[model samples]
Target: MTRRDIEFDAEGVTLRGWFYPAEGATGPAPTIVATHGFSAVKEMYLDVYAEAFAAAGLNAVVYDHRNFGASDGEPRQEIDPVAQVRDYRHAITFASTLAETDPQRIGVWGSSYSGAHVLVVAAIDRRVKAVVSQVPLVSGLANLYALVRADFVGGLRESFDVDREARYAGDSPAMIPVVSEDPLGPAALPTADSWTWFTDTAKLRAPAWRNETTLRSVEMFTEYEPVAHIAAISPTPLLLMPAQHDHLTPTRLAIDAYERAREPKKIVILPGGHFDAYVDGFSVSSTAATDWFVEHLQP
Candidate 1:
């Protein structure tokens, strides 16, 4: 496997990551554009899948979202769902221009929040030939309610309102921790396990990872609905892999989305939590992913 540094324009900001050429690709090969979930950088685990894809004769392009990792952007450590989705489109366009991969055979893969982004991208972009969504964050409201207690729910909205006003007044966006020891803290993901897994992964593999995002990033979820677009992606092969015991994304949402999905779709329920897909969970998920890409991309 060989990797080279790469960058692409998402609107005007520059986002960067690595591009791995297929090990035995003799010509333009199938390609998959991939990235990480909320508050995560590519080095955390995307390389594990990209390396496998490259070894299997599939070109893999992994990149950091703007304002995170090595990507260049202002208002550092931001997480904008809409802007990130746009980046996926830019990445697909960039991947298609690569002489080493087949643009028409391009696919997309993502986990956690990005897992949901892949769904929306595939629905709107016919250029995406296939998709792999692992432990996808299906609904914004459901995800928010799960993280915050009922009593503080109103308080949460107040905070968002106040922050919105501050931003409108030209004040810098308030920052918040991406995860916290207390589920009630001013954080996005407050589960103890989420905190442990994120911190551990950052220390072990992703020194570039940041543990915070602008407060405004949280509100983007309220308007984003990936499930609404799942059915529109028919004829294009879709693979939904959600852990059986996923605590964060919730298995029920993925299953509901699967029920609504049309033919040319497959779902694998792994026996672990959401982060399991990163640890021992990758074996089944990646194996199925390789087979799916080979069948659909056929390059």
Candidate 2:
């Protein structure tokens, strides 16, 4: 196998990425660009997915969004939805120029927050031939509403506190633990498996993955909705894999978005919550995703 860490210029930002090619493979092959989700880095998912695609004779490009991970940017952990989408587009453009890649067969893969990004990117950019959104958060408002309903007063207080700290520290607002020990709260903050996945993954990262995102991120996200553009991606294959018991992103939202999407789309519902598929013990969903990309990209 051939692997290289590369950097590319995108919208005045220097994006960091990794390219993986199968060993002894020659000539161009189908390429997939994988983007990470909120508070996650490229290194988290790149290795597993890249190896899967590369073993199937496909090249994979995994990139870190600017302002997060190893990518160059100020105000670390600030979630800029527009910038994230732009980075996705730049990754595709960079993949297209690779001599070992089939530019016309480019695919986009994303999960959680980025899952929605993949949809919007493919809709606006006709160059994207295929997309795989795993347990995607189709609507920002839906997610926030869920969060609020779970703990209206507490959620509001937390948001304000985060915003204050962010401004005082001259940084983006920080979020509470996705899973906590408290009761009567968002399941994402209390689930045992969610904690395991995050802590274990943090151990594998440098500086221990400190992802304190801007509190105003919610404010920005409330106005951004990827489901609104699903129809724009007609003719291109879209795979929607929603976790049955997902708490981070409700499965119903994903199903609704898939139903609204145009022809040439597929929906696969797996058993588990939002983060289950990313960790161990949820091989069904992960395998289904791998197969979906392989089938569509046709390496």
Candidate 3:
């Protein structure tokens, strides 16, 4: 497997990352386009997944979402679900243009936030032949409610309004930690596991990973609903992988969304929490996705 640094224009923003050509392939081969979740960048184990796909004779394009990691965008660390979805389509277009890519044999693989994005992308973009959405956010509003305390919900909304006003007045967007040591602290992801996984992964694999994002990013997240597009992803084969003990995206919510998806779809229940899918359960998660892509894309 060989990896090369690559970038392409997504609208006007320049998104950058690695492209791994399928190993031992003599011609154009099936390709998988992937990006990370939430505030994650390509360095945080995305390379590992890409290598796995490449070694299995499937080309892999792995990049960071705009405004994070090596990607170019304004407001540095903002998270806009709508923009991310559009970027995924742009990535597909770029992938289709590659010499090593069999445009018709393209599959999409995403986990967590991008997982949800792939669901929406596959529904609207017929160019996507197959999809693997792992531990995706089904309903952002529901997820916010699940992760936040009832008493804090109103305050959180108020903070959003306050931040909007500040931004309207030309003040820089307010920043918030992506995760915190104190579970009850104000952060995008408050789970103990999120803190551990993000901090530890950053330390070991991605020094460029930051701990902050714009406050409005959280507001935008609460308004996202990718599951609304789930049922439409049929005809295009779908593989839904939800971790058994996930609380960040909630296992039940993922299962419910999976039930709504039409046929030519399958689900693999991973044996750990959300973050575990990338670490402890990586072999299971990556293998399931690799096999699915192989079955459908025939790389």
Candidate 4:
């Protein structure tokens, strides 16, 4: 239950993080790096998973993506998939140096956008012993297609605006609301409940959480495709936890990624939608994650 604030430099960017050690952890223990999804802070779902892992005798490191939360970056809130994947590598490297962690027993757990990130990281970094990609966004192109198909004109306009802003500022672009006011709506905006939850959560965060990112993040979709790298990670343990009714990242996409991945893998389909995995019915996915890490990393 012991927690500490930490900072590390990644590719020249000063990144912020939290380290959670098991209550009685005195010796080397399996460790987990918990990364959050797009537009979310480490304080969101990472804490939930971190506490659970710590209770189970694992040390947990949760960090903010550059440009969001307490992390340092320019053109704030811009989604850079390449940067995200790089940050994962940096986090894993940093976690390996912790005195309380077993350097060889390192696992990466990512949700939503980061789900795909962890996979890409594991593929490139043999040091990653295990991976958990929860409700992953496998193909950025497919995701964009889905958005355009839902509302072509609106999607186009949003993309144009994001691009214009990024070009104008000569830096990273911003993004629109990924969740919708109406869960069933064609275009996405934060749901009323989601907005409320974020507002409440913000009150508990530190000063480092005050940054806002640009909207030109759509560019990353065309540049980074994590699903294509799945087969390259042969023999590494992977766990895909997809929500049955996930609207943010389609369940079908995650299933396709699972099918393409190499052996030593598992697919756990849980009930509820995307946000539900963070709020209501979260225990379903959380428990599955705990068991997965215990079986793969702790062993």
TM-score, one value per model? 0.97, 0.87, 0.99, 0.87
lDDT of each: 0.88, 0.77, 0.95, 0.78
Candidate 1 ranges with C-alpha deviation above 4 Å: none
Tens digit of per-residue lDDT, candidate 2, span 197-274: 666777875353563555555556666799998988888898889988887688888998999999898888877787
Error of 1 at 17 (Å): 0.7
Candidate 3 lDDT at 176 equals 99
lDDT of 1 by residue, 1-299 (tens): 57999998888999899999988888999999999999899988899999889888899999998899899997898788888999999999999899997888999999999999999999999999999998999888887776678888898789899999999999999999998877667787878779989999989998887789987788877667889899998878999998998878889888998999898999988768989888887888888888888889873
Report the C-alpha lDDT of model 4 over 183-285, residue by residue, as the tens digit: 5443232345445545555576533443233445655654568998998777889989989987567888889888999899999998887667776767888
**Which candidate comes out best when scored by lDDT?**
3
| True-structure RMSD for candidate 4 | 3.2
**lDDT comparing candidate 2 with the true structure:** 0.77
Global lDDT for candidate 4?
0.78
**Model 2: colliding residue pairs:** 173-213, 173-214, 173-215, 178-188, 178-189, 179-189, 179-190, 180-189, 180-190
- Which portions of model 2 show Cα errors greater than 4 Å? 150-193, 204-208
Better of 2 and 4 by lDDT: 4
Model 2 TM? 0.87
Candidate 1, number of clashes: 0
Q: What's the lDDT for residue 75 in model 1?
A: 87
lDDT, candidate 4, at 135: 84
RMSD of 1: 1.1
List candidate 3 segments past 4 Å from native: none
Candidate 4, residue 116: lDDT: 86
